[model samples]
Target: MTGEDILYPPRASAFSWRIFKTGEIHTVSVGRRKFSADFQLVFRLIKGLIFLTFISILVTMIALPHMTIQDIVVCILAFMPTGWGMLQIAQALKPLVRRAGFWGSVKTLARGYEIVMGLLLFTPVAFLAWFPFVSEFQTRMLFNQAFSRGLQISRILGGQRKGRSSRNKE
Candidate 1:
């Protein structure tokens, strides 16, 4: 046993095991010690739910002839903040993506493409000042860690709009 291992012993908790079983905890091996990363588990779960919601909406729009172009436009506009939020989340998780290998790289590129398309589709809404606020709120509710990381990225990127702040700002 190494001195480092003795100083920082690993404890296998029931909660960690449960999360592991759900496939959210990824075990990363460094030397002989294995570590489970539970950091982005909540964020992944929330993203999965949001993706399913988007898919369902797309199916509904395709199946219903009654859904007009205006309705589609409105939906796109409404989801702009969400797209932006996802972008921020993606940025925050870039390090993890690098470690995730080829498929992760492909997914990141796909997400970038989708964000660009959405911005083009709703160019006017993309300039709105309220998007950051909404995105922050969504991030806070879903994953606090991502929220903080996103804020740091936003600060570094600059160009944030000044307006009425959300209640959750600290």
Candidate 2:
């Protein structure tokens, strides 16, 4: 056995098997090592839930002539976690933002622009919300692209690429 293998025995590899809480700090155990982070796994799940809620609400709003009081309340509640998750994700990415230098600053500014646009949607000036909304939406899409690019780079650097399937290769 390699010295590294002796130092760290093989452990469960599936991150999906674990449950994480939203409020508190927790440790993720990997073989003999542990990691702690400000944003827990639960927030990631919450973010996904938020996205689903958004799509559902949009569809429902479009389908219905008018929304009931209950529908409004539910929509508000569903949207709360989206704002929370966005803040948490931004907080979690602070270190990476610092490490990325100039491009990071641009991303940070884009995030700020998104927040500003979100706030503008609530103001009397919201008549122009469409303009800012497009900018905010584009910023988010680009930011997501950058994040995925970073992940791909990290995977390549770490030697963890899964080879293409036969169909994909062809």
Candidate 3:
């Protein structure tokens, strides 16, 4: 056996498997090695769960005024679309960020813009409600940020793309 083989026992060769007229062979992956497809399945599963969570939060955001936890829970949960969702989207875009060489910088900047907007739209209300001592200037700044951030975060969470408006719009 080669040194590499001694260090890591060779896994069963997939091609070595006998393909009879039968449907398939149930071979469990024995060694510590996990196939690349397994990793893909796991990533997809995580993405699905996050999507479900975002949908639930969006529903909550829409169906306001009748929930039990209004003051804190509602406020915090409301930002799920913007704060949590866009951050997740930015993370998801890592591969895309790595790809397009010429457009990478521009797209990455756009992604950052989206995340910032998401924070602006959703974070302030929660902050204001939770933290009592925020000054007027801070509030206005937060308000201004939210207008753009809401769109950014929304787009991050699988919503359509939204660009930031001019300062005059704020």
Candidate 4:
């Protein structure tokens, strides 16, 4: 391999849908580079905490009789991405199940359970996304990393332009 290749490895790329400000959804390429183990752990921990928080809020909204329609709608919008993310974790773990030993067999059963749960979780969201705005919002939430990366690139380019402008004025 060349020195440049060794120094700067190629980033992983995946295709995902992105929602534009004008309410158009389009499939776009996104980076999927590996994160540090520590970062992964912390990110998973934070995600779990956020999921729990949303679940609690949802339960409260259901249990209270004084909930407004707006509150219900807001809760649903917030909860979809949280639930989708958790199900995604379950889907990710399915392939890791082993089936050779007793524990492996147990894990296989657990994997089956996870698959069932993932289907259950996905069904409602799949239906909900049939609506245009809901689908746009869901896509925006799920592919947020792509949007953030775009913003970062813009900021860097903007800074470079400003630097050139200042140098030209000097």
Instruction: Report lDDT per candidate.
Output: 0.50, 0.47, 0.45, 0.49
Clashing pairs in model 1? Answer: none
Off by over 4 Å in 1: 1-60, 102-170
Off by over 4 Å in 2: 1-66, 95-170
- lDDT of model 1, residue 89: 75
Q: Which TM-score value belongs to model 3?
A: 0.21
By TM-score, the better pick of 1 and 4 is: 1
- TM-score, per-candidate, Cα-based: 0.27, 0.21, 0.21, 0.26
Better of 3 and 4 by lDDT: 4
The digit string of per-residue lDDT tens for model 1 on 19-75 reads 332232122122112222554565555557656755675566445534456655655
Error of 3 at 73 (Å): 19
Q: Residue by residue across 49-164, what tens digits does model 3's lDDT show?
A: 65675567546534542334343344444433444444456567766645733233334445655786789777977777665566665767778876756656655654332234
lDDT by residue for model 4 (35-140), tens: 3354677655655665675567546644643446664565445544544554456456655522321233333434644676789899888888789999788778
Prediction 2 TM-score vs. true: 0.21
Clashes of each: 0, 0, 7, 0
lDDT order, best first, reads: 1, 4, 2, 3
Cα-lDDT of candidate 4: 0.49
**Alpha carbon lDDT of residue 152, candidate 2?**
75
lDDT (10s digit) by residue, model 2, range 1-170: 76644543322111111112211111112211222254556656555665675567446553553445565455445444554564467567777745753333334434655776688566745555568786787677878876766757667755543444544677
